[model samples]
Target: MQRDAARLLYGNAVAGIMISLLTSSFLVFAFSYPRVDPLKKMWWFGMFILLLFRFIDVIWWKIKLQNTEFDGKKSITHFVIGANITAIMWSIYLVYCTNQVNDVQLTTTIIAIAATAGGSATVLAAHKYTAMFYPCILLVPGSIGLLLSEEKSLHLLGILGLSFAFVMLLISRKSANFTVHTLFLKNENSVLIDSMEEKVKQRTQKIYELSNLDPLTRLYNRTAFLEQLKRVTTKSEKQFALLFIDLDGFKKINDSIGHKAGDDILRETANRLNQFTSNTQLVCRWGGDEFLVVFAETDEKRAVEKSNKLISLLSEPHTTENSILSVGATIGIALYPNHAKTEDRLIQLADMAMYYQKKQMRSAVCVFNEEMEELFAYDLHLKNGLTKAIENKELRLVFQPIISSQTLKVAAFEALLRWQLKGKDIPPDEFISIAEQYGLIHEIGAWVLNQACLEVKNWNTEQEVIVCVNVSVIQLQDDNFISIVESALSENLIPPELLHIEITESVFASDLVVITDQIKSLQAMGIQVSIDDFGTGYSSLSAMQDLAVNMVKIDRSFVNKIDSNGKAIISAVMHMSEALNFTVIAEGVETQEQSQALLNLGVHYFQGYHYSRPLEIKNIPAYLEENQNNT
Candidate 1:
């Protein structure tokens, strides 16, 4: 308030000086009407000197003090003193005119005093004391001088002058109150706007954190990593190496110990990476059990060295509350402007290299090469060809019979999808992974469901046999999967009890509550659910109990090694199946020895090439007839 008052006082100083000079000129001329007098001259000189000092003060304020942080109270005090003295000088001139000049001159002097006092009441209102006092000084003494004169007309004029001074004081008080109130409201509004801006900033920061950061590891997420990659590839002219790291056997450890211990391992991995990498290098938690690191300005040798160091760093045993867990990593390195120039291709090649290393040699580092590029291109070709596989009639279903171990009769058939493009066979793992990655699994899964239901309904077997179709995790999580099942069953007129939905045990790692609800809903609708590849995934026993699936198919990996302690693992699963009241089917029984061993261990069913390779729709009837004859 004081600053504003002082600024306003000086801001219009030139205008005020002009008005004062004009008023003083008029008074001097009026007082010196007949001849020049020393009194008028002295009054003119005093006014000129005061105006000169005020003009210089304003100039000095503009030059040195206008934008500074100097205290305004001192300036305000100086303004008040100068303003009051000027008013006093004008009052003395008014009194002199009243005593020495004629009635006309005195009236002119009174008019000038009234005008100046009224203008001051409004102009100086920023400071209440100055506004009220300056006008009073200009009006009070002149009015008293007129009232003390003997002239009757002068006495009436004096009374009116006093009344006008009182009115000006009231006007000054009201203007000053309004000015103070407006400034107070302005300050309050400023504070409110500032607070609102701060809150918006905080919320925006929170939103960024939620979107760009991984909540568990507090590392940059996939979205943030991709964004950074795009920026670096676009703006940077220098080369950088992109490292894709996958934690080897993390799922096995997670499943064996617990997810909590797995989470501790992941956090420790992230902490180690963050500590090991410098600011110039970027690190991110790309997804579950995988991380991405970018080394700025590097070559293949340096990248290999860094990759080895990272593998060693991550492979160290991590200590959780109840467990000391050890995990290893496989790193794939792809260089910018060396292998691929674009961000997508760079990340793709890097991931392919990492996958190659993981598949060939666990816990190692591999740099991308031309051979990997060719392999990636082949996969890409398969991915592109898969989109039209169904349209081209190149996609077909082959059913493998699940036989009863005791009766040696076909009990169920698992429908599997096959894609043959130009007579070149694409493995299920290759094409299925591509399908899931490119978001084409939903369409392909629905097609498989409908086709399997239609094909199984046409099977002319006397005994009713169930048809099991493998479902992807993506398909199960989809909101429309249940509806797809209903559509297939209703369209094909297949019995709901005869259709089995085979889900992998990895489903337990996902949204368990929702998946469990989905499983229960399927069971309620008379459709049985089976956990395919049972021992392969790290599904908890409690999750398995909660699912209460109808059947558990031992993964072929365990069956391939059935002679060497694989039976122990399968025996444990068999015991779990008996305790949980579910049946067990041993898959991939390519040898009679393995089959006999499994049957001796009390296995319920068998499905593998040892019985029959997956047969076509036309071949199924003959196989069943031949099997019935054998029975």
Candidate 2:
């Protein structure tokens, strides 16, 4: 920057010197024409010597300016000295040339002073003092020479010249000031343009970062992860693997506690994932409750080992403001060039493996395979069809009678869901698991409760027959599940005692406060609570103690055995049931021996194929009528 300024100064000064010298030479010759005075000659000669010396000094300075221009202090010092010398020399020339004060001589001196002073406006105006002094020096001496006039006309001309010199000085000051103002604005405008350019670059970079990052977890978003997958897959030699991680039971946690808890879980999960992942660039937030990771130049064995480590770490509890939350993860792995050549296909296979593993482990890590992929395709079809199954009348209720062992009569009927798609019956295990896996249980379970209540209302037996409908852990976690239950009872004009809700022990495996509160709410509405599939889940007796349960239904696994051990387990369960003052219903009494074994253990109620297979809603009327007369 300094170099450029110095260059401009050098060029302008040289040009001004040459122009001033040429114009003044013509004026000097014309004024000194005919015979010159001796005193005037000597004065002119002395002034010429000074002027010549100053001009040569400026020429030397200009030549050296090329080398010393960038030294800011030296360049400014040289310019100032050269400018001051020129001012002094011009003042001397004016004084000496106008000593006689002849009309022609006075005119010539005035013309020379004007021309010389005007040149400084362009060259030295940017330096305020230099421009101001140039005109002052030229005019001050000339006006003084005129002031010493003896003639009246000469005295008047002297006064006029003095006034004119004063006016010209004012003009020079303004020109210098205007030049300073122009320099200031040019500098400011250049700075402003540079600042705007920098700001634009910063904003553009920030926008790019936001587009590719997930706001909550601070991980890569779906779009960026896909781009990464494409980049990795394009390499033919280097192998990489894609991992899809899904947080299991996250929806239940979100619905039960709140979304804030879910968010905490997600952030903590991302942190944990980042710790296990050596490469930060490989982790991504694959939308809600799922993440995508890449292992560049990693083999399938190492991928599986890392996935297991991830699972173990994820299973550790995360403490939030309200609760200690812990959830499992399901990871699906697919290798590059091994699973598929294309990026989309690799991601698809990994995603399929993730869902497949989640279904089998109900949450764990597994690698992609042709079998798992094919099963996932079928499961995908089932999941998509399961949502619409209830609406399409593809699903219906089938009542399995639970009969009293001593009376040999129907005590209550458990409503089981049956799915028949396109004249082909889809097993409960297939469709129900699909529903639970994808959080459709809330929708499906509510429908079951509503349909059962309405169907039982149609029976109108007046015998206070109970209609038991199974509730899922997901359904129990739903905030609106209790409302749906109450609505079903009230809307159907059935007393809550005539309806029973059966929840498996898995529901107790969730938040105890939330689960117990829901069960208490159900019991408060006069609805009977039963822990179904007992002995098959974690515990049988202790959860019943927490719950306001009216009955405990033994899981079919325990009853179908009929071994001494099964009887012993049933005996302990019966004793516990009596102590708790709740009825015990033995499920899966498919043979006389299983029923007899249950009865000998002091169990009264039984349900299985031996008594009656699950009857469809339409066929229940005929069975109820036949049994109604007999009972």
Candidate 3:
């Protein structure tokens, strides 16, 4: 809008100056003429007024040009040259109009020629196509009239000059219109380009944010965390801590509650973790229920303290729509430049430590140590051996008889796992721990459950002797474990009452609310659930009552030292089980003293090396037959 107005004012000034120059040239011609009449003087005065008006218009255009924002010196120079040419043209016109000359006829001819020459000169000086045509159309004809008719030349010059002036005015008008249209188009294009750039910038920013964030929890995802880990590790020489936390009982939560509720819990858990760490640490959703925390400039003690704080924070009751639930986390800490030199190694070491801690304590934090490296190496070796065990048929299920203490007869056999590496027996404790550590327990547990079910099907017993299999914490945590158990039962065509699933105290320690619900679901199918190594864990009396368990096996630690520390513990366990209406089984009985002590404590079942060691499926039939005949 502003640009169009400036162009209009400039064009008008050019037209006005052209009129003034023509009036001035006519006045010069009138002065050379001898006939100085009243009419001629009036004509001169009229030319003066036109020149004055032209000068006033020029001043007005100069003010407008001063106000206008010139793009460059080129536009300013163009306007100046056009204005100067128009001024010169107006002066020549005024000199011719005055009609004052020494020789009237000669002066009129000279003035006419001079006006034509001056107009041509003005057009050349202006260097404009529109101004060039004006001289040829108006000035050339007026100059030819001076050579021909004396009376008609002045009138002819006036008429022709006005026509040229109008032509110049029209050209200037068109130029102004074209200038306004061009500026409008350029401005619109500029705005469109700016808008596109802004949109691109916004989209790029959104993509960057999405790439770094976890979709489920809105926390920093694994990729982003690892990149940050690399940066922090590289810049700082000070030791930092990397904590790998895995939620205990998350699978049970998923199974008992729907996946939606489980996801809600996970998101809530992420929020809690973020709040707990705040700005002092970097908390990342490290896939599933696991999280990784990178603590800068922190040592082993501070890291452990932080882990404990986090554990304590998580242990608080979490409110869901269904119930008030409590969840626990097992944290594994690995120190920078101490436990590992690189970021990948550090994360791996931390994960290993966390799993080891989960296996040992089940719900406690553990730091990586040199001893852990040895244990990890041993576990790795066992994992390799176990992987090959299936191919070699070296992985075997051994049955240890759980005999009735009063009847002194076999009641049921607990299926224990044994691995033989090249005909040499590996202890159940050694390889079982390895299997759990390496996440191979699911496969091993399935093998044992299947073998035990098959063996139970083949057994010949008048009494309904049940086969119990110890399910690892890892196995219980598996979503497929229940399906595997159901399939095994169906494959063997054994009644659900004949099979019992034995879970250790540690399994209950993890996500107990979920574990109990899962156990109840299993119980609904008529399969028995027993707490193995019961007295060793921190199971509350209320929890024991709430859990739909059929039996509670007294831990060997309590059974072995029944006369000493075990006596009181075993007595308490038996009484507690009796009070809860749960059957009691005493494990690890090797001596008459231990046996007598448990019997006195009202232990109904006994399992030990004294009765029979865990045996192969082939050996179990003859042993059970012999024991039945002996009884």
| Per-prediction TM-score to the true structure, in the order listed | 0.63, 0.74, 0.66
Question: Best candidate per TM-score, number?
Answer: 2
Cα-based lDDT for every prediction:
0.88, 0.78, 0.74
- Which whole-number lDDT from 0 to 100 does residue 255 have in model 1? 59
- Better candidate by TM-score, 1 or 2: 2
lDDT of 1: 0.88
lDDT tens digits, residues 125-226, model 1? 778888998888888888988899988779888888899989999999999888777767876787789899999999999899999989889889989988
Q: Is candidate 1 or candidate 3 better by lDDT?
A: 1
Give the lDDT ranking, best first. 1, 2, 3
Candidate rank order under TM-score: 2, 3, 1
lDDT of 3 by residue, 387-497 (tens): 878778997777889989999998888987777897788888888877776677778788888888988988877777899988887777667777998999999999999
Alpha-carbon error at 411 in model 1, in Å? 2.1
lDDT of 2: 0.78
**Residue 584 C-alpha lDDT in model 3:** 89
